[model samples]
Target: MNKPNQETLDELKAIYVQKIKAEFPKQLKNFSDKNAKEHQLSQLRGYLHKLVGSGESFGYTDITHTARAAESIATSLMSESTKDKPSRLTYLVKLLEKLAGIVDKIEIESPVTLHSGANFTDRQSNAKLLTVGQAHIAKTERKHTICVWVIDDDESVAAQLSEQLLSFGFDVAYFLSCAAFKQALLSSQPHFVIADVRLEDNSDFYRCADLHRIDLKSFGLIIMSAFDDFHARIKAVRSGAITYLQKPINVARVASFIHEHKNKIQLHPERILIIDDDTDLSALYKSQLEAAGMAVHNLSDPRKVMAAIQEYQPDLVLIDLYMPDFSGMELAAVIRQFDNFTSLPIVYISSETDNQRQSKAIATGGADEFITKPVSADILITALRTRVKRARQLNALISKDSLTGLLKHSAIKEAVKSEIARTSRDRQSLCISMLDIDRFKRVNDTYGHAVGDTVIESLANLLTQRVRQTDHVGRYGGEEFMLVMPGCDAESAQVILDDIRERFSNIEFTVGNKGFHCTVSAGFVQLEASVFLPTADSLVEHADSALYEAKNTGRNRVVQSITARI
Candidate 1:
């Protein structure tokens, strides 16, 4: 787990310290009245519990320990079984007095201490821009250089895996032992490590331990073994292996897994919505999450939550359990009522320490998790990242085409609509390309549907590989595909699509002992906000018409839309 900026964190901590100083004494004074003590003890306990959580999170060890002790006493007094209430009350007051003294002694560091680490916010923003053609080609070119290191005692296994990864555009290095890998780590770091479980020295289980001791940062570990024993699997999990593969590996599967994992981890930004009545606390959270590269929106008013969700379209919702108008559970229930947000992740962040209340909130509101306040920044980021990644995966399953893994027809149309709106606002150029496999039905009739399916998949792969990451590709219908390229002018798009047409024609398809080549015909419509008012339907219709002309003129060629030609 990574942390946000140290200076911002220090500022937030200082604010929290001042907050404790201003509020604790007033809260503790309520305990002095015997009649009010019974009524106010619960409130006091809640306050102290908050201190205990936030203090530890902000590195205030003394405050956390003291508050924990005072909270325990308060909880005991509230219970019906407590008999020596006066004695416990006296002890609680002394602890509270000690806490006040500790707060007075606390000093915030003035000068900032900067830590050199990757900027999460920049990475997230780049991911969003990648979808809109804002990031340049260099970024995509750099992705080709992802380094993967393989450690296997078997020379043949290492060589085979390394060669496969290299063919997939990964930089690959292989070593026979952990020692060699460790030695290589002195110079450069690899993005991923594929290690064998059975090392020559039988120190396989300690490989991950060695990496941890050396403090390796930001790399994935994969463990492979010939033995599928339960103990081996357990050790792999204990060693923090991200994935485990058995012997007789599918090289293609490994390559696909790496590509999928890399794209999923690197390309998505976490969108978070925070609803809390305490404006200061919400601001602190907003700053922290944003600094960590998440797009965050915070609201002090729960009444506007639905509208915010609609506009922001968050990946996860973080709600404070106690609010002025509606509790976190109540808001979650309202969100769950809508079918669109039913599967959205809703997490409760609060200082309430009662186990029963937390459980009740989760069950009643259909919340995913109940996170107690005072969570470390690293833990918070990691937890939210895991949830967001899972949610995105689920979304892809629902919206992506099964065969080609591109957006489905409806999803891509919706994407075009959204992109068109964005282009209109930004005053940018957008291109929509419609592609059809030439004589695709004839091929199915001659070679069978399976071969035709292969042709479609091949074209999908080619288009996806050739296009920019910011572009969207979809299976529009049988034998047809659609591409939405933002910030791309007509001339550039024409050349790119022509290049794809040439490449697709060169790919040889085989059926039994026969081998043949297939060609694709494509037509594209480019829209400049200054020249034309582009709607999604018109873009699709014009592109399709151009595609129809291309098919009529020549079976394999790229054509610009007639509307754009004029």
Candidate 2:
């Protein structure tokens, strides 16, 4: 296997370091609380167990052994028998102390940039701005329509904050007070409400029951207070505030907070495959997962686990511990054999809650997690959501371009290969296109690299918006991109690409006071159902030839590959 380029390694490293920073504090707090509640201890043990397994994989050998030992002690303490809890707690503390030292020693060249103004943040913000357009275009582009209700008595603050949020693409609604908000709620409810902690009439915050309405997901509550009293904060939390912000807040930070929470409610529905012989229980689980906006498929046949996984391409899998044909652990081992499914999470669902036995099963079977039966709906949802989110983050770190958020070079190739197989198997029409920015090198030389980057990002954003949702768009490399259009012929593909090319060329870009325009040359190859299908590599080569042809012809047009049997 070839070693990855330095850029890819740097991206992967940066993501791992960020994960450590974000998670280490919570893990340390949990580890230090030897007298924590049982559930807290259980959570700590599970986290440490996962950390132990993943830390080594990411080359954090410094803490892996210590985390592994701590996990063992945690497992012992969490077991039903409590006779050894005192000794295990002492030993776990020692291990944690040592682990802290190890964590301090593990070095990462770069830190995660969470705040604005950082290079990554600036890139993301600028790229998003490229998508800034008319109200309806923004609405169509948004994955979920997030309507934020801001209830504050201060008209000045409310007006300014509303404008800022609207800039961030949120549908904003403002109210003068809680009374107005409640009246509006009676007719329509927003996804999130940001209200002052105190009202002039002292009316109770939102009715908690309204948020618990089963017909819809729970609404978000954010409390804004001018007071710094401990009781005020506590009251806000008790009143169901997901976030509490002080007065004179940075509106941008507030928007970021709300958007972060909004993302929780609007994630792309993760796909999950469940293999359990208990049909009734599986169906119940399936419905619960679906209610959380996950795509779920449940199969009663344990023997078909591999086939089901390949077909569903699920982010996570749930398997019953006891099945008539095979045990969940055995099936998990089989699934791990396939390289494509190696990172897919396999969680075992069983009635047994014994910590020791669960640890052993996890280790022996190479599974990610074990959930005892009779779990609460919230716990199940939270557990699966956390795993899926982490897996996706990891996947993005390795597969996504750092600057543009498009698939990396290698990932795009893999996508092309997969598309070829899919089109061949289904006998569907498909088109592959290559696009290159005209005179990109000249832009970088003329107006610094940052301006050049802005040009690239603008084009990427245009492609993301103009293309159909079903199309696959990736940044093949610098100044070049690949587009795979399934169920489309050369004519339709050309129409779409040509339109994008025109729109992209019309985008007015500026560096200081000087302004300029950019254009793209695109070429496509269509796989006709009646013609002999070409290999992915062959198609890519033909598309490249066509792209150059477009560049040679006039420098800003779409050209079709001359790949017919003629």
RMSD values, in order shown:
8.8, 19.7
Best by lDDT: 1
In candidate 1 the C-alpha lDDT for residue 427 amounts to 83
**Which of the numbered candidates is closest to the native, going by highest TM-score?**
1
How much is the lDDT of residue 448 in candidate 2? 81
If candidate 2 were superposed on the true structure by all CA atoms, what would the RMSD be?
Answer: 19.7
Worst 10 residues of 2 by lDDT: 208-217
- In order, candidate lDDTs are 0.76, 0.71
Tens-digit lDDT track of model 2 for 435-461: 999999999999889877777766765
Q: Write the per-residue lDDT of candidate 1 for residues 1-566, one digit (tens) a residue.
A: 23555655665666676666678778866667355456688788777766775676677788888998998898888885567777787888889899989987877556333222235335434754564364232234434345678889889989977865554445678988777777777666676788887777666546644664644334777778888988888877776667889866654456545655566344345889988776546656766777677878877789998889876789999998976458899999999999778999999998777899999999999999888877766777788878988888898899998877789999999879977876777788889999999888899999998777777777776666577767899999998999999899999999989978887776656566576878889999988876456678988999999899999997799889977632
Model 2's TM-score against the true structure? 0.56
C-alpha TM-scores of all predictions: 0.62, 0.56
Off by over 4 Å in 2: 1-267, 468-470, 529-533, 564-566
